[model samples]
Target: MQKPEIQQLLDKSFSDFTTFIGSLSDHRFIVSPEGKWSAGQQLDHLIRSAKPVNKALSMPRFFLRWFGKPAKASRSFEEIRDVYRDRLQHGAVSTRPYIPPVTEIGQRETLLKQFDQQKSKMIGLVGNWDEPELDRYQLPHPLLGKLTTREVLYFTIYHNYHHLHTLQLREKPEQPWPTQLERVIF
Candidate 1:
């Protein structure tokens, strides 16, 4: 996606997620589903995940260049999504740094604010770069290795929705969630 489109999506996706998370009851927000993360933990995880990306984007171009450029062209959003999904299927999980601590109900509002700040900051940082610069620089993704800046944005956009889908499934167990790959709409 273009920079403007990516910024729009970054705004929309994080806004939707924080809105949903903010609406959760204290009990639901803190309670984990079996072995999965609680809603609050998910929120924390997202905040943790976005920090580095935001940091990377905020860096000087010379600093980012240290990571080098993509070996080939950037991948489409679908391709990145599919690769991520496949990795998850094969047992990939959050590395230690990204794992969130137990989140208390009292921390909900604070966490929500942090998420909003991170999202806003990220959107603003994205605005600093033009289209080709997005494809010209690279950053290391813990799970996906080095990705072009554009691909990083793509992954960030999809990652929000992926977590949103997971939270939705847990929130409404009685409702049948979509099962196929295409089900992760947006």
Candidate 2:
């Protein structure tokens, strides 16, 4: 797709994702039921993913050599699933599934706010860049392959949804929050 159109799509997706992330407020239930990291930790992981994303966006470009060819990378749910298993084996929770912690009661709101801010920066990064700029050079994705910057952004977009799906499964967030909440929370 053209750069402008892709940017527009990126903006819309970013808006939706921000809204979704903002809506998530089941901090009380994330880890209690599963003994995993709480919704806070899950969001931590999402914010963590952005660390690399920010580094990538700041890089000169990964597609410099790839004026042709696919110049991109793709990921599948199964691959991320395997990563989750590996993380479990190492004793650190993968944060693959989004479960809020029942323990750390103090950091939930701050953590979520951090995610919101970082997410906005990420959207800004994508908004200024486009598909064609992705054809500058190739970089190695942790699992996916050496690909252009654009492909990395593609992974970023899909990766957010992937975790969101995982969180949805973990949270089972069908019911609405209480009426007099402090956060108008998810």
Candidate 3:
């Protein structure tokens, strides 16, 4: 069974994502600031990220244990999140297959539905696994090496928050002085 804490975290994360998407206007969903991905692409990326994880979660425990090696040690969510953040800060980019398509008009509803569906499947798959399974099974992260199944779930949680922050930054009005004006004044 999913530990109560993990379930709660999943619940909150899903709820937060749904609320965030619901609040966005269609134009805002597809509007990226400069070179960044739009909010819709970020949501699409989250959907893509969840698929392999859900598939991995569905594999038999025997299969996972047989193919995967033991994790070094179980790390807290914060540790895993910090390592992931550092990698991004240092220029780790999403693999080609994981990058979402350009956010076109009218795509928000479709993308949001996909995100919700994937998240629900993820929650269901993980919920079926007990604590022992969560800790015993390991998977290779693209950047973080081997991680217990629990840590993967933690990544899913924080990954949403990371993109949410990005989306929020894009949405913020440009209140700072214009670059040209600043240069002239200085």
Candidate 4:
């Protein structure tokens, strides 16, 4: 039973995340800004982001209670990347080896569809559960120590918005910048 407020947050986050991903045209996907990683890399990164959310969903209540939430349970900066890699069915998308595998507009559309579908699974996994999404009831983070399952939810959604902001900037670099960016400031 997800609380209404949190559920609203999750729903809005999902909507926003998809919108960000969808905005990228096939041409934009290939644009990595400075030959670093094109929008393609970022979009793939966003979809790959869902893998760990599902992995955490699969953990047993006992394991979660014992482990609490891992510091980087939501997104990979470095800490959780390997865990996410090991769990990936086909391995995480590599930013290197720069293969421009001619994925079509239809293919990109399918990927976005898959992203939303997988995200639905994630929402189902964490919804209204007595058990924590993280391995332990509480865990330590570099900035915020000793956070609970609920806090993990907040962290996860905010993390989504964090990247969305970056993606939005890529979408619109000319604008001076909106006074208020997408919601999720809390």
The residue ranges of model 3 lying beyond 4 angstroms of the native Cα positions read: 173-186
lDDT of 1 by residue, 1-186 (tens): 788899999999999998888777787788765568989999999999999999999999999878986899999999999999999999999999999999998899899999999999999999999999999999999999999999999999999999998998876655443332224343
- Which candidate leads in lDDT? 1
Candidate 4 per-residue lDDT over residues 84-128, each given as its tens digit: 335444544444332334344556767667667766776777663
Q: Which stretches of model 2 miss by more than 4 angstroms?
A: 4-32, 62-103, 173-186
Judge candidate 2 at residue 70 and give its lDDT.
Answer: 49
Best by TM-score: 1
Can you write out model 2's per-residue Cα lDDT over 132-167, one digit (the tens) per residue?
555554555555446556556555665666666655
Error of 2 at 113 (Å): 2.6
Task: Give the per-residue lDDT digits (tens) of candidate 3, residues 118-178.
Answer: 8778878877998877888898777777789988889888888888777666555564324
Residue 26, model 2: lDDT of: 50
- Candidate ranking under TM-score, highest first, comes to 1, 3, 2, 4
Name the TM-score of candidate 1. Answer: 0.92
Give candidate 1's error at residue 93 in angstroms: 0.3
Task: Give every collision pair in model 3.
Answer: 1-130
